[model samples]
Target: MNPNGPLLHFVIAAGLLDSFNPCAIAVLLIFIALMFTLSKNRSAILSMGFVYIMFIFLTYLAIGLGLLKIITIFSIPHLIVKIGAWIVIIVGLWGLKDTLFPGKRNILAIPIGSRQLIASWATKATIPAAAVTGILVGLTEFPCSGAVYIATLTLLSSSTTFLKGLIYLIVYNFMFVLPLIVLLLIAANRMILEKMINLDEMNSDRIRVISALIMIGIGIVILKWFV
Candidate 1:
């Protein structure tokens, strides 16, 4: 199970960085409200988020399978360590860009922006923009698919069963929002959510920029030491 594994903090840190990213934050807040509107207890809220996160893990696992096929060709020594370092830096840069340009979104590619999907339960259907948003954020939030990401790929590749890797990935994802969830509670229910929604655009941008830079710097240190 790799209990007490080194990857624990690394994944948590990456998730945290992503959770706070401008795009990620926007989606997370929306999802929080979405889930709250649907069900409000901590358990219910977490369960809804789990459904969304599991969807992400399902897709990531599929990617892991595809990567397994690709890994064999260059499997002659994977540079898991180096790649992890690179991912850290790239993610940092991505955050830095958004922070500096608060109002603008840097994504240019087709998959860079939001996608629409229909979600249904018991014959009722609604636009599950938030779930889609959550899934997208989970996938792209990695600074760069580095050694950590690759090593995760490598582990999934080597495993006889995929559940092990998938479980780790899921846990890693949940930990990312622990802080924000806590912050939400401390703010006294969704009362302050309105304030978060109404935050001054420029001020919010500057805050994100500074936080993203700090996250990037931490990632560099991770590459240098931990990974």
Candidate 2:
């Protein structure tokens, strides 16, 4: 077996799971809703959605590449990875608490000010506005869904060459946006879009729990092997 196969599998799986980020999904839904209100043209809505997803993909890819470059340059110590692993675990636990307690405190959310800005951009319902919103959400939603990403980056730093890591980062970001792409496709159908929105709202807490578990598992795996 290729020695790196397990790591590659983990990266793909983490990327898929990370796509369920509540903040990202919420923002996309908000954009979709705003688009519906502003325009009756299906093509225009899809165009905006595509632009939004692409910008998010690009933004996240840039962040991963930048982080990888910094790690390579600084020769980030293994101890830091270990610490990061623990932090990931803690963040996962915090997510669970937030889910169960119904928001006693939510440190993982995008800031309210940033969310308002995103909403304002989304309300514009144009390709350029969507592109900007995507960039903003990509930057701001990290705290809400970054534990898995941090774990993936740590694993990539320790386990792969920089060139290979870059390839994985591209793949990862694509997977991160895959869900949005699906939503964008079905968004042309108002009924289906409404159903999806309702479903997401009903099970959001459950989804959060699942996401938290995955993060904790990834953290443990990193501590065991990669760190």
Candidate 3:
């Protein structure tokens, strides 16, 4: 249960790749736009955004902890790690497919079933409303953005104690939320949302390609280390 270089690398890499997912970015953008319309008060906007991000951080952490427990409880750690490596490889290849074929959606993306719900929840701008939206969005977006998280949890389940896993989960989620915080700050400064949206659109393919490569690298590392 000692932390090692590969384990830490996988955790951090998974978080960073997962954070760049288009679905999460889109929801944050919508929330920011709604916040702008709700009030010109920069302080209030930043405060509500913080609340939203806080909820997101909490929700994701809770899920990671819960998953760690479940994964540890149900199977032998080594077996689970091997299974997880295969899953990561499959998901990595799926990402590669999306990058190569551009129009076809990646299976790892947010599920169609949850997209409408996520969009609906993201429209709320009040602190309570945004907090609830954050929780819901975090849960709902899992299917679309959970590959890295699952892989990291699988890695952790095999190699770390509960407390260490908790600490690593905190680190991973912090990295996950870092980009959203940066985007929120940018939007708070009166930068246009359209520009951000356009930028995402422009770089999305390249992002996918980069994400695919990283996932593949992590998958290979896990496969080699575990299998």
lDDT of 3 by residue, 73-113 (tens): 86588788877777767777887787787555675466666
Evaluate all candidate structures by whole-model CA lDDT and list the values in order.
0.49, 0.81, 0.78
Candidate 2 total steric clashes: 0
- lDDT by residue (29-110, candidate 2, tens digit) is 7788778887657888888889999999999889889887776664665866786688789998998888888664575567
Error of 3 at 101 (Å): 3.3
Per-residue lDDT tens digits for candidate 1, residues 52-163, read 5555545554554565556544543336444644655565567567545644454311133332222222012123543554455545543322223444454334432355
TM-score of 2: 0.91
Ordered by lDDT, highest first, the candidates read 2, 3, 1
Worst 10 residues of 1 by lDDT: 116-125
- In candidate 3 the C-alpha lDDT for residue 65 amounts to 93
Candidate 1 lDDT for residue 161: 39
List candidate 2 stretches off by more than 4 Å: 1-4
